[model samples]
Each structure stands twice: as structure tokens, then as C-alpha cells.
Target: MAKISINLATGSLQQEEIIVGIDLGTTNSLVAYINPEKNPQVINDMGRGILVPSIVHFNEKGDALVGNEAKEFLTTDPENTIFSVKRLLGRSYNDVAAHQDTFSYKVIDDDKESLVKIKAGNRFYTPIELSAEILKELKSRAEHSLKTPVNRAVITVPAYFNDSQRQATRDAGKLAGLDVLRIVNEPTAASLAYGIGLDPSEHKTIAVYDLGGGTFDVSILAIQNGIFEVLATNGNTFLGGDDFDRAIVHYWIESNKLKEAELQANPGLMQQLRLKAEEAKIALTTQNIYNEKLGDIWCSITRITFQELIKVRVQETLDSCKQALKDAKLKTTAIDEVVLVGGSTRTPYVKQQVADFFGRQPHDQINPDEVVALGAAIQADILAGNRSDILLLDVTPLSLGIETMGGLMDVIIPRNAKIPTKAGRQYTTSIDGQVNMKISIFQGERDLVKENRKLAEFDLKGIPAMPAGFPKVDINFLLNADGILTVQAVELRSGVKQEIEITPAYGLTDDVVEKMLVDSITYAKSDVAQRMLIEAKSEGEQLVYTVERFISKNGQVLDEEETKITLVHIEALKAALQDGDKDLILKKADDLNEFTRPFAERLMDLAVSKAMKGKSVD
Candidate 1:
């Protein structure tokens, strides 16, 4: 066999395609790629450092500046500098309504059900659009550093992210002009960076505790045959190192005895104190105490006090660890390794507590903040098919589908299907002469539609009117490699079609998703029974409507006895609909349909005959 030659200068594989990995974080974001040396490396553009503050600012002319450039305006133009945008991604106004006071920038409360929008200067921006701005900057930095046009990337999200949040990330990547190859979970990416699943024959189980600036999650993963599977994930989207900073701020405000009204009135002073608190939090990591001053205000905090303030917060994260273990159906002893991933894990107290809780020393050799990105780069390399020894597969955590009649969830892609998969099912009109079909997409494992989370809704119009159940409406769900979904609805006979990319920009809150899953498990039997009753009730109601409408139009054509018999059947169905009895409702509806079929057919034949009387045979 001929030996492959290597170019040592650029450290890139021969004829290799460069694909970057991105950690589009809440507080900061960065990009990385595998170098020609075959090692994953983060791009440092013009020596600007690896971490880019995920902040954006707009000027009077409405020009946008991102990263470090936009960080300075957080104090000077607090209303225009947007930060912590990742928390708002895939979130509705109501989902973040409780934390509205945290942002200095304007988060417009347009509609509770709609996605949150930020008002910068005179423009309104969705989180997907805003996140794209940050991703674009990361893209530019990668191209500048690597001296190549980088177009494809693997992006990481929290392990507990619902389908909506994951899709929102993919949309942002698309908006940023990057072909997002995969949406990797932070825990899985961190594990990959640590080489936990690199060896195909070695099997391991681990827990990844990720506490970033604005979010925290603990994931239990089982790696077998070089394939990593996420068993369970738990955490809060609003808790992180930023909260530790805030705890210091709260202590200083009390130490100085400063009035809340004063801080509220003076945004500049608040920003100063906030920034100072951040400094103290970092300084106290090594030093016993931290002290500083801002004008007339004194900022002081001891390491002991700092730890005390964050004790409950740290415990909350540990509580999540317990829950993750519980959800995974594994004891802590089952975990063979514990990995740390996130900037906040640098805190000595956090590291010690995590270690104590796990009964072992957690792996922190790699930089917590950069490990996720590095892992993503490695995944990109694998996707490039450079590594034959590794195999990684990701699955959707919840079932996804559309709402059917009687408020039932008709699952198309069930939970645990491998990503980049496609599934479809055929549906039909519920009523005769129905020309339009409404498709409402939902995500959850519940039997009833109302019990699940609604992702998006659209109408498949222009369907040809036909007898009930005669039209075939094929609904297909295409989930790409990135885990983003595109829904297509087609009328097979007429070729009338409608399709929508399901981007849940205003997604449900983290708690709601978790609750939906739990409820699906806890109340599965009741939900199914409720669904059947609702279906029976719906059938009865529809039959009543049809019978009444028929009488209004053709009562004169029928004899008195026929009209009376039809009225009796309609009454029986209506009574069954009210009684809430499934079997009785179905029986009554069927009785009415059977009684009226002959008359309905006779009327149709008569109408055709009348029309034919005035026309010649073709």
C-alpha cells in the first residue's frame, strides 16, 4: 500500500474539508476545529483571546456590533446592549416573564404565547435572528484564523433542551449562513472531548456536570461500543455562575446598606456594582477575601461568605444530579467516571462539592469552558469520516407528531428514534366536502393533544372536496441531521400541498417539557381513556350537525315519516354526546348514519337526475 503524505505546515489533512465546532453559549460563545496536526484547537482571532462575550449592541444608525466590541456598551448603553440571549432562545414571553427584571436591554412583551423579541434601537429581533449574529461572528473568526472559508459546523446545546430549543439553534446556524451538520448535546460533546467513547471496545458510563455562565445541567450517559447515549438530563436554565455573581452583589448591597430604589434609579451604579461583584467572585476563588471600592461605595466579600451565599445554589445543582441518577434508573455507583464541563466548574467550592457528591474525583484536566467546543470539533472530524473507530448516535428525547380528531396526539416520530430520520402517516377529512385540513404539531408522549406541548400550526388548504375519509392527506416529518424538523402535507389525489419548517421559536419552558414527560408516564391510562371518550363525543357531535343540515336543505323532498325518523336519530346521538358514554355515543352516531344513508343517496341521485333533465348525453 502507498503511504499517505502529510503537510506539517498547516496541520490539515490532505484534501480535507474544514468543519468547525461551535459552543453558542448564553454568556459567551466560541468556535473550534481540528488542525492539520489532527488536534482540536479553538480559533483565537488576532490575539483577541478564545472566549467571545455573547453580547450584541446597536448604535444610533442601527449598526450591530458583537462579542468583545459590544461588551463595553453594557454600561454606557445598557438599553441597547443585549446579553444572556441564550436564555431567551426558543422561549415565549411567558416562559421568561418571571426574569424580566434581569435584563437591562429591552425584551418586548408583545404576546405571551409568541417568542420573546428584543428591541435594539428601533428594530425588533427574534432570539434566533440575534443568535445568528453571534454565530456569524464566530464563523468570521474561524475563517480569519484558519485562512479558509468554513461553512459547516457542529453546535452544542444543553442536554435537557426540548425539540423546540434544539431546532431554534439549527435555525440560527442556517441564518448565520452555516450548514449545521449536527446539534450535539453539551454533555455528549464534553464526554467526547475527554475521549470517553473513543475506543470501540471499551464500555463506560459517566455523568457530565455542566454549569455554564447562565445555565446548568447534569447528564448521565452510557457509552457502549464507541456510541454515547444520553440516559437522562436535569437542570435549570436560569441558574449558573451569573447567579453566584448576583449573590455577591446582593451581599454588597446589604453590606453598604444601599437602597434598592437607589440601584433601580441609577443603572450605572448598579452596573458598576455588578461588574465589581463579578471581580470579587473570580478573585475569591483563590484568595481568602476580596475587597474593592467603586466611587463612594465599598465592595467587600470574604471567601467564607461567598461560599455561604452560594451554598443553596450549589446544593440545587447536586439535587439535579440526584434526579438525573434517578431518572436514568442508575445509582451513583453505576457511573464509572465523572466529567466536569463549564466555566463555573472552576470554582473550588463547586469542584469540591461535585467530587464529594459523586464519591470520586471528577475529570477537569481540559478547560471546562472549551471542552464542549473541542468535543464538537472532534465530532466534526468524525462526521468528516476521518475517524473509523468512533460511532456516535443521537436520539430525539420525546415523541413528535400532529393533533388528530378528538384532541389525540398521533405520533409520527416516536421517542428514541435516531436523528436525521423521516416518518409519515396518511390522514383524511373528518367531514364530507371538507376542503381544508389543519395540522397542529405537538411534542410530548401524552395520548391527548391537550396534554402535550404545541410546537407549531399550519393549514393545508386547496384540498378537493370529497366524501369523508375519501381524501388522502399524507403528513410527513423530515428531521434532518441537525435535528431540525420540516413538516410536509400533501393531498395525494389533487396534488395540493402545504409544508412548514417547525421552528418553535417561542418554545415551552424547561419545566413544562419535563412536566409533560412525567405526566405522560404518570397518567398514561387516564389519558387514553379520556382520548377515546372525546373521540366518541366528537363523532356524535359531527353526526348531529350533518343530520340537522340535511334536514334544513331537503326536508321538503322527504315524507313526514322520513323527517320524523331522522329527527329521532339526531336526538339519540345528541343525548349520547351529552351522557359522556363512549360505547353509547358510537352506537347512537352509527344508528343515525345508517338510517340517513339511504335518503342521502336518494337525494343525491335526484339532484343528478334534475341536472341531467336539462342536458344532452355526452
Candidate 2:
């Protein structure tokens, strides 16, 4: 055998290829790469254009449909369509199962795998599997668009995603056969995006208000000399555009005298209403009022009306923003510029709210949807050793700690501490004859262990038995550049190292991720396709069912021609569903919904009447 040669410097035997950056989101995903000229650019796939909707549809043929194609099937196959997989990444089944009602997909319980299974036709899938499909689709798009086989990438996650969720996101990338070099926070990535066009000498404090499809994040940063430091950050993992859509849907149902259960049962109608609501929200940005005709349902909404409806939700965002600024020890006036990130910020009402809160107009120069991805690409370039001039110093979003006496949390690393930082704490045996000491680590702002999120727990073993308070254990916690924590323990007297295994309290383990990947690949083809067919069939059934029910309940409210047109569109949708054609199913669904414009209007009127009567009664 030839002698092996090892190079210790740089920890590489040979030069590595350049890396890319990916934004794997709840509602959409995008891939960007640094070109040879050193500029970052997003790679657009042929079929799906630029941004891929983070929706996966398992069709009848067991094929997985991703992006817009999959989103189109959500209404028809609500049971099999999986969106917002990001929320489930690295999370336990129990953690996400409680919020199943918030999603449009069917989440089945799987005790054996400790996974949340998504039901699609005859098959079931774990959250990791669904996320892997989206990741794979993104990988394919990046490779095809770049015309090169890309291997290395930097992926972004929510700042508030627990250690388990972060690990899950990394596992998804691994399952998709991509090497994730680092996992950056979404808001930090947005800051990087803004830094690209900005002057480093500005040395100003910037606030990023990022409200995306399924999450909201607010981060305050201080920039100077090409150094970007995240001072503080806060967000709700379960809040975003989805919530706004739900808020509007609630308003419509109450205004039209529609039953909540009826809306829930009819996925097609829900889709229609969500789509209309989203349109109205966008329209309110530039126009004061807009009219929507959904089949026999016709309704008009003004900007003021939309503002009043979402005022509470908007206020919540403001509150979080204020809290983030407070945590950073800065006031609104201290912020030099407020950059808005995320698609949901396109709403004029949201812009106005942000402006009023900050006492200044929000910046809208950059594309909200693309900014985060662009920033991620820049970070990828830095990791690829292409941009040594720039450096990013991000902070921990939550405090890391352990449980102490009285169930109180003893904080180790306080939140907002700079990354690649280390802290050590010394502990002594509490009882006589103690041979092992367990350290439970928690992350969150809460003072109690039960209130905060438990990040991990590890035991330091192989300790000599000692009298009470005699044994000394030194524990060191280090957060790396990726924001993941690592711990080490050393016995003071013996100078011996103890085994330390971190068990995340809320995140999935590596073993679980591997199993999920295997399962997803095993049923990748047929399960996805079958799930799609089921969704299409379901949408068709729902549209026809809702239309029929509406006609039966309010037939006298519509004229003869209006009734005939509505019936014709319903028949068309029913026929399309029978033939199992997705395109036809969608077209007819839209047409029939349009024909019922008058009925929809009457329904809103009835809902308003009921609300007014309830108020009087109260």
C-alpha cells in the first residue's frame, strides 16, 4: 500500500467546488448560485419559472408533483397535499400534530417512527419525506438551471426553529443528495441581501421586518466595515401570509352567513375564497376598492375594510417588532433604515402599519421575495472562499439554559450573544455517592423550564462517587457559525473526559431522518402521483357538493339565467373530475365559482346580518 499523505491546513486534500445558497421555505423555495464573475444570481427552472411553491402533491400514479403543479392540486386533494413542511422539519410528531388543524394536509399519527405521517390515497408519508421531495425538486431545478452538477449549498431556516427543526432541514438537504455547508437564519440572510447594494461605511442600524408565507421574523442589525452583526431577533414560526388568508376567510364567512364547518368540509370553496382574499389584499396596496365575482357570489371590498379586518393581526406584528427593537436595546428612532422582506409585505396595509410604527416609510426598493435568497447566495459565496472581505456575525435568537431548583431555568448563553462564542459553567455534586450528572439545556426567553423550549439534555458519566458538593464538573457550551450548539465536559480533579450526548427535547435525531429518507425514496414515484389524483378528485367533489348545497339553501336568491350558468359550470367541473383531468378540473372549478357570484354576495350579506344581530343580542 502507498503511504497516505494528510494535509492539516484548511482540512482539505484538494480544492472544493463553489457552493450555492437555497431558501427552503414553507410556501416557496428558491436556489441561487455565485457566478464566476462573483455576482450572485437565482437559477430558474424551466417548468416552474423562478420560485417553486413549497407544495408537494402525491398523485394516483405514485409520482410526486412539486411547485405550482402541486399547489394546483391542493384543493382537490387536501388530504394528500403537503405544504409548510418547514414547520415540521426537525420537530417531533407531537410538536406538529397539535397544529394539524392549521394546515390543509392530512397529518396521520405514526407512533413507530415517531413521525407525523401525511395520508395520500393508500400511502402515508413522514414530514421529513415530504420535505425531502421539495428539496429534491429544488436541487433538480438548480442543477438544470445552472447547467452544472451542484453539490454544496447553504440553506436557511427560521431564526426561531429549534435545534431539532434545524437538524431536520439539514437532513432534508442530505436526503436530496446535497451537501449543506451551513444553516443561516432567514432574517440574517435578508440582511445579507440588503448588504449587497449598500455601502459598508454607512454604519447604521437596520431593522428587517420579514413576514413570509408561513412565518414572521424581525431582526435588528448593526452594520460597519463590511461586518454585519445581528443584535436581536424575534418571530412566530406559525405566523405569516397563511394567517392573513385565514383572517380574510373568517371575515368572508361571517359576513356571508356561511357555516365554518361547511367551509372546512368544502376544500374547493376554501381555495376559491383564499385566492380571492389574497387578490383583494394585493389590490388594496394600490387601489382603494376591488370587486370579485365568484360564480353567483359577487362582493366588493375597500382598502379601509381590509385594514380594519387585519388590524389586530397587523398590530401583533408591530408588537413583535417593538419587542425585537427593545431586546436590541434600541428605539425606533435609532433605526437608520427599515427593510421589509417577505411576500406578505406587498400588502399596502402591512406597509402602512410598518411605516406608522416606525414613524417613517418602509423601504420597498428590493424585491421582498427574492431578497432572502439573494442574501443566502452571498453567504454561500463567502463560505466558498470567494468573498473574504465581508463577514456576518449573527446571534442566538433564544437563551440556552438548564433546569435548576424550583423548576426555574438557569441560563447559560444569553440571547443576542455573537456566534462562534463559548461559555463555561461549573457545577458540583448535589448528593453523596453521585457518579453521574445530567445537564438539561433549554432555549427560549421564558424563566421556567416548562415555559421555555427544551433544546437538549446530556449526561456527564464516569464520575467517581463523591460526597455531596465534592465533585466538580466543568461544562462548556459552544455555538458555531451555523448557530448549532455543542457541549463538552471535563472533570476537574481527575482530568478525565466524560461522554456527552445531546438529546434534543423538541427536534428529530439523525437516525429518524435517515429512516424518513429511506421511506420517502421507497414510495417516491407512485405515492406522490396517487396523492395528486386523490386531491383532484376531492376538489371536484367539493366544488360540486358546495354548489349544489348553495343552490338548495338559497335558490330563491338567484335569477333563472344566473342559476343556469352556475349549474352549467358545476356540471363541467363534475365531468372533468370523472375524466381525471387536473387542468379541466381547475378550469371548471374556477368557472362554476365565478357563475355563483350573486350567491356569494348574498351569503356575505347574511353573515353581516347575523353578526349585527348577535351584537344587538349581546
Candidate 3:
């Protein structure tokens, strides 16, 4: 009877859900939607909460595991598990080659293309495919949680990510079978989450300092009633918690006399060490010392010592902050409140440094880890026309230009310039009877071509082969709201247009991504066990090297009881290594590290006291 009289306009079926926002990060990824109540809620996958670790693991059954489950296997099955795939997105083999030693994955050179090949059992897969697997998981999560098909989304990226990187991110979204409406910068997304609204007078200027798991970004924004405009943004794509982990790992190795060769042989050892180092860094935020038994390694690390080792990195974040302020032409005092986003900001030392720099305490009102995703959701609402009172106008983080006559970079769009902007330059033939014009695009603030990040290269053919400077070619560079570059060239004399189909020199191509998926699925079964063995061997080596170094360097200073404890840990680790039980080796490593806690604390206190004396000069 109700069906006969029901009006569709008054029923639940009458309304449709709009768009959603996604933060596709290096360490983690999340999706959120704006509900009918105008509240942003994170969508969970299969009853799990928000905040999915951006990781993927290929199991022996040819099934792919993503999120937290995948991250758990990172050290245990490193060869089959891939994390931090975001860093390699849109990057060339050469761009990531020098830093291959830093990542856990194996990078293979395929002619000119650099491929991230994950070895599992008897098979290997590329980075792009692995990334797609993660994306697919995310898509499924959103669809299952919302109980509605998620066809469109607004994904956020690093402000400093170049055109190629941006394109790669878009490709990933496409592979996941979702329509990517727009690619917003991470920092700008955070500002939207703040809900400054479009009142220019209320918040004239604001700064977003984002230190995420694998990257750091600083963005200066100016809000005019409902318009959140990004004035300038800059950051190190490779700097963040990951760097801090490496710094501490370096300290652990040097202090314990860990040999480089041993670490090379046992890759899993480094992963374990990195995990411990991260824990120590986090613990130091609230306590004076971090004490724990890592597997078999007994270690006590002091906050003061950890701070000393990471001070330079902390300073670097501040430097980026200052530069952002300078770019906005605003003083530190002009900033009403400094908004800190990202898990790294949880560090007390980092918070204190930011306070001292701005002469004010940073706002901790928002959840550091969830703020970016929240902001992205807010932007999604605005883009879907669900929220009209908010507008986000973000800028390009780096300067966009082309190479000039002397191998110099000529800026067409200066860094920090407003978005949806276009600029054009005219070029003439270099030599007599020149047939075509060559254009090289770069993204950076450097005056020299080599100093900037090369984006793409294209040739404008079909020139009339005119004498030296007769033919005129108009080159135009267009930067969209998402900060991607679209270039075009027109031969003025013949009204003929020639343009280059720009592909990122560093990121994955569409064909490559498809190939990776097939390979990952094919080799999933055999790779799991082999990957574990390799990782375990690596962890064992790291433990042995660290203990040997610690004993050699601090032996003379240890008392009888301390020496006995140290010896016990060392002997345990050594015994485990001999047996080739990766788990046991790790357990012993933790015990040894714990035994040296007291000594590490004492050394840190002394070092801090000495350093403060130098810093206190008026």
C-alpha cells in the first residue's frame, strides 16, 4: 500500500551522496565523506577505523593484503611488502637511484626507466603496481564502509610534488577505478579542515607546517572571506619521520660499532633498528629516557641524546617555516596561530622549537595525523557544491619555467604565485635555418637549469626553417588548480600548433602499472617465505654489529655489574644469529640494547649540558 502512495522526492532514495576526499600519503592513506549533517566522518573498511597504513603485501596465495595488515609484514616479509611507495611516485629511476640504499625495496634499472621490483618467492613486481594494489584496497574500504559506490574523489598530494608526480597520483586513482575530481595540496587541505571560511578579514594569513611519515611541507595561506588562498609553499619531498629514523639508526650503529657490511647482508636488521629508533624518538617526547627490550636487544635510549642527534633536522623544519613566512611577506609575529599537522609534530622538542621560532605556542586543537584527511573531506564538500561558504585557492610550490639560451632557467610562473594562472613567452630560432624549437621545462627556484627539478622536454617541430631569428614560436605554460603543468607551442608564421605529450620522467607510466599488477598476482605465493628469510638475516646482522661497537667504545667506562649485563645480551644475540632464527636474533638484540640504557642516559645529559652552554650566548 505504501509503495503505491510513496513519493520519491520525500524518501531517502531522493538524495544522493556527493564526493569524498582522500589523503594518499607516503606512510598512510585515509578516506572521509561529508555526511548530511555537515560533519566529516572517516569511512572505515569492513568495520575497521580510519587511517590505513599505505602499505601492500603479496602473500603466497597470490592475494594482496593492504593497510595495517600489510604494514605488519614489512619487516617479516620485506621483499613482498612495499611501504613508502608515495616517494617513488612520478619519479625516474635516476631520481631515486642515489637513495636506493635508504629504502627497503629493490630498485632495478630497466633501460632508462627505474623500476621498483619487489622480489617475492620466484617473482618480482613494480612499484606502480604495488601502489595500485594499495589504492584498490582503499577504494574497496570506502565503498564497503559507506555502503555506496565511491565513483569520484578529491585526492591530496604534497605541495612540492611536480607535474609528473601529480600525474602519477592521478594514474593511481584511475587504476583504482575511481574518478579523481581534483588533486589538492596536503597543506592547503589542512587549511580547509581548519574551516577559516571565506572571510578575508577574519584570518588574513596562516601557515601550515606539515611533517608527515615520509615527507615535510610548509605552506603559507591568506584567507579572504571564503577564499583560502595559498601564497607560497615549499618542502623537502624526502624529509620527515623517515629521516629522523635514519638519523637514530645511524647513531645506534655508530655507538654500538655496527658494521656497514653486516647491515648490507641483513636487511631486516635495519628495519628492526628503525622500528626501535622510532619508538625511542616518540618516547623521548614525554620522558627523559626510552627503555625497552627490542626482541633480544636490551637498550635504554635517552631523550636528550635523541634530541641532540635530531636537532639539525628539527632546525631544517624551522628553516622551511621561516622561508614560507618570508615568501608570504609576513613576519613571525603576524601569524595569529601556527597550525601543526602530521605525526612528527607530536615530538615535544619539535613543538618547543616551533614555539620559540614563532614566539607563540602552536595550536594542537586538531588531531595531527587526521587533520589532513579531515581537510580533504571539507574540500570535497566544497567542490561538490555542498558547502558554498568555503573556497580554497592554492598556489604552485615551485617555480615553473623553461631553459634559456645559456642553460639557464627562465621563470614563467614564479613560486608562490596564485593558481588557475597562465604565462607565455616567445622563442626564436638559435642558429641559421633552424628547423625546430627545443623546449625544456623545469620546476624549482634555481637560476641554473641543473639546480632545478626537470619536469619534461619536448620539441616544437614544423618550423619553416627560417634564418637565425625569423620564425617566431609562442610557448605557453598553464598551471591548473591542482598545480599540474600543460604546455603548448604555436608557430606564429603558419598558425600551426605543436605540443608535447608530457609524461613524468620519474613516475610510472600506465602500461608499467598494468604489468606490475600481473606480475604481483602471478608470484604472490612463493615470495612470502623467501622475503621473510632475507629480512630476518638482515636484522640479525644489524644486532651483532651494534653490540660489537657498543662494547668496543664504552667497555672501558663500564663497571662490573654493567659489563656482566652487556655480556649477557651480546652472548644471547650471538647465539640466536648462529641458529638463524630471525625472531630469536631480534629478541636478543632488544635485551642488549636495554642493558645499555643507563649508560646512554648519562651520556645524553652530558652532551646536552655542553651544547646548551654554546647556545646560551647573548
lDDT of candidate 1 over 462-536, digit per residue (tens): 999898768998999998766679999999999999989875324455455445544554574466457657755
Candidate 2 lDDT trough over 10 residues, lowest sum: 4-13
Could you give candidate 3's per-residue lDDT for residues 145-206 as a string of tens digits? 77887756778887777765775666566556654556788877777677654344575577
Name the runs in model 3 displaced over 4 angstroms.
1-15, 46-49, 59-63, 76-80, 106-129, 197-203, 249-269, 391-618
Q: Candidates ranked by lDDT, best first?
A: 1, 2, 3
Which candidate has the highest TM-score of all? 1
Each candidate's clash count: 3, 47, 50
Better of 2 and 3 by TM-score: 2
Per-residue lDDT value at 113 in model 1: 48
Best by lDDT: 1
**Measured by C-alpha RMSD in angstroms, how accurate is candidate 2?**
17.4
**Candidate that beats the other on lDDT, 2 or 3, i.e. the better one:** 2
lDDT of 2 by residue, 1-618 (tens): 212121211111123565778888878888887777877788777755778999998888779999898887876777778888877775555887668788876564422123345667656565666887888888888877777767667888766765556655665665676656567877778777766324556687888898988888888888777656778888787778878777777777777778778867876887898899888777778899878777755546888887788788778889999899889999999988888988999988898889998988877877888877888888777655566565435655445777754465555665434566777667676555888778787764344467556666777777888765567778777877666677777889777565343433245433333343233334434433444455446545755776787799778778898889888888788888889765456556656755675687887787788788875311
* Candidate 1 ranges beyond 4 A from true positions: 1-15, 108-112, 259-265, 392-618
For each candidate in turn, the TM-score is: 0.65, 0.63, 0.61
